[model samples]
Target chain A: MGHVDHNTAREQLETIRTLMDRASTYRRALAPAMTAVGLIGTLAGLAAPFVIRDNARSFAFYWLAVGLAGACTAFLLMRRQAFAAGEPFWTPPARRVASALMPALFAGTAVVGPLVNIHQEGAMIAVALPPLWLVLYGCSVHSAGFFMPRGMRLFGWGFVIAGLLSALAAANPHQIEPSIRMAHTVMTATFGGGHLAYGLYLHWTEKKPTA
Target chain B: MNPEPFPHLDRVIHEKARLAIISSLSATPSLTYTDLRNLLVMTDGNLTSHLRILQEAGLVALSKSTGETRPQTTYTLTDIGRNAFTQYLGHLEQIVAQFRKTTPSA
Candidate 1:
């Protein structure tokens, strides 16, 4: 006879592994759609100047204003999600970074975005946001790994990867980059909507059993 | 013929080593690797191996830090793990009480 009773321990461990697998599956499915959205947002934010104004100087100021506003929208939206769980997602260090980094990043980047039409700095900073987020997401997970659901931990890591790609794509363009805007689509799809999708799938459906 | 659910938590917990680790950590919030090994009266390898298994299962996580001086490692349980452990203890108590009541010698 075997010395160890592997059956019970194996079954319990399997349950957790199952949850993480489902979460990863859900995010992978959603990633492309999100990338598309961010691309669209970037294009829209980029094109807003052509719609409202044409000259470089006027466009820069107007684009900066709108970018600031869009970034503001993103911040507020993130805050709502963070607060909804009674501040569950924001670890103390994460909160500290987000408080200082988000506003400063967005505000600074908005000024830079329209400038991207004429200058490379805007694209550089935009590129930085997603990866910076990725590093932050990893730390957040590794720190809260204990209390978080298995699904949530995987989700955190996924966003980190997605964020890095988005940042890389965003920062590379010299003038009016379409790819980073697409990156936003990717980020939103994977991190924002992808999270909601994973939650909904687990909440609404019973997972099929696996051996 | 008889059929009922098997025990939720059995005498497995009354074992001194596992119980000490679970109960002590429950009060302390989080514990370092050394702290756990010391409390459970286990050797370093014994605790490390168990903690690794727990972490891989997502029941626990270990953190490593390297500051100016040396490295540090710590472990803590996740929400699901904590809940399950708590419920297991409660269910075990109930089972014990039920058996105590029905025993013929009592």
Candidate 2:
């Protein structure tokens, strides 16, 4: 028999270890938290029309409240999941996810200030902001999927596609009302429905197998 | 063939099991004993032996704390260990690169 190749063995072992590390998803990504954020998004979308009826100015603040609530929900749930897992919320994996996601989020937030001002001036620029927000959010989520599960990337892509469509609709002068409704529907489906679906999937699949 | 392509390979960290253990610990800030065992898929005794060797070599540090119900043991790579691992990986990469350069193509 040929002698065993230590170098080849070492390389194989290293490859396996690397794969395992990459495959290990961040358990603290909290599906339930995502679902909560989705619920909040749905509620906000439902309330947006009534709250901002005939007043475009209130649109910004209403969505801002939704964003804040979603952020808080995600943060609290992540903290809880981390503690339960006997790890810190800001672990190496979590930090990687955040690092990947932050640039897009910062860009979105930065653009919002200008967009809100334009909207206050009664310009159509404000109409396009929501989809822009979605596109940015989708980019962030897609980047974050690198450090998360395989399915997350698909979710991210869904947001991106929806964002593009919404933006297209918003750009059409004749399609403003339908476009606004479409944006809300997309928001509800992506944030609300997406979260619930993914959360339930995680809860079912990730639960420890009983002996 | 070169007489010694990897003269500086740290023998203590070169073993397969020990390398795996060190590599795993290096990726995280700290890992519990159970976490390591499950990750490496090694028996308690096998893992303990490797951990002991690394611990003795000052390549890994163990911290023990009482959880709400029981004591927990976690392992972290020491700064020295981190440097050593990085150096070892560099050497391995060099070796692989050299091998690829010299080997005839099929």
Candidate 3:
């Protein structure tokens, strides 16, 4: 039988191993940023009715705007793999739901307030907006047999935990108090910092260019 | 360690392809079905048959997951697989070492 080059074969095996590990790490780092914004948007959605209990429709509308945006972002990133190249295309677009988007939507909605003449129950509907959007976003991102390292799974579990806790608090009067922030922090760290750490660890050990 | 006077490759651990698979798994956390498929580059029926052999021999482990889209399978070396691969390397090293002492290379 022809002989095998044991030494060279071993080296090739090691090099490939490093590359796969690094790719997984890079995937981890970006996952959290995408998830956190969507998560907060969802929470804000669920909280809208309770916060602005009197104007349910207005609240629902605002939440709906945020939630829809999150779902769209998830669709662009996860489903289509549009920006998977890790270049400028990979960077997530400006989040309209959380910081500027919410205020802008609120202002726009308020301006239209007299025209629509939204009552209190109409305002309560705003709270459901983010959750509804988030549900859609989650659905869009959900896929089977997609490759994910253990780190991604950890981040996902964090989100589920956050959502459940937030729901429990939302059921009570003091839903907005402490647990929400904790969930946000945990989710951010687990997905953002967690992914970056995973990436760096893999990069340091890896022999090839994983990015 | 010295090379055994009667050194024969262990059947379960000695085959080159299976050895290559275990060696690859030892270093990576896991390899996907497609990744291993492309790496081995054997026909589906052939790879499946070999993998089944290794799996039955308890030198490899396999798992399957159903993602929202499709089912993905992954492979990893078992603890025994790692030990066997390592021992194979060590055995090769001893053979070279013995050869070097008994007869210097030209």
**What tens digits encode model 2's per-residue C-alpha lDDT throughout B1-106?**
3425466778888787898888888767887787677666789999999999999999999999775445678899999999998887776666666566677561
Against the native complex, each candidate's DockQ, computed on alpha carbons, is: 0.03, 0.24, 0.03
- For each candidate, the alpha-carbon lDDT, in order, equals 0.47, 0.72, 0.47
lDDT of 2 by residue, A1-211 (tens): 1122336635745764684475344544456777788778878777766766433345555666677788888988887765665545677777888888899888877876777666564535445767777889899999999878677888788788878987787778785664345545666676667677777777776545111
**iRMSD (Å), candidate 2:** 5.4
Question: lDDT at B34 for candidate 1?
Answer: 48
User: Candidates 1 and 2: which is better by TM-score?
Assistant: 2
Best by TM-score: 2
Q: Determine which window of 10 residues in candidate 1 chain A has minimal summed lDDT.
A: A22-31
Index of the highest-DockQ prediction: 2
Weakest lDDT window of 10 consecutive positions for candidate 3 chain A: A137-146
TM-scores for candidates 1 onward, in order: 0.32, 0.80, 0.36
Candidate 1 residue-wise lDDT, A1-211, digit = tens: 1111223333433443443232222111222322333444455554653464333343345434543554455445544543432222344433443444454345444544444465443334334544564556545643343333345467557766766766655555664464344434444455445544654565455332110
Off by over 4 Å in 1: A1-121, A167-180, A205-211, B1-106
lDDT for model 2 comes to 0.72
Give all candidate RMSDs, comma-separated: 17.1, 3.9, 15.7
Stretches of candidate 3 off by over 4 Å are A1-211, B1-8
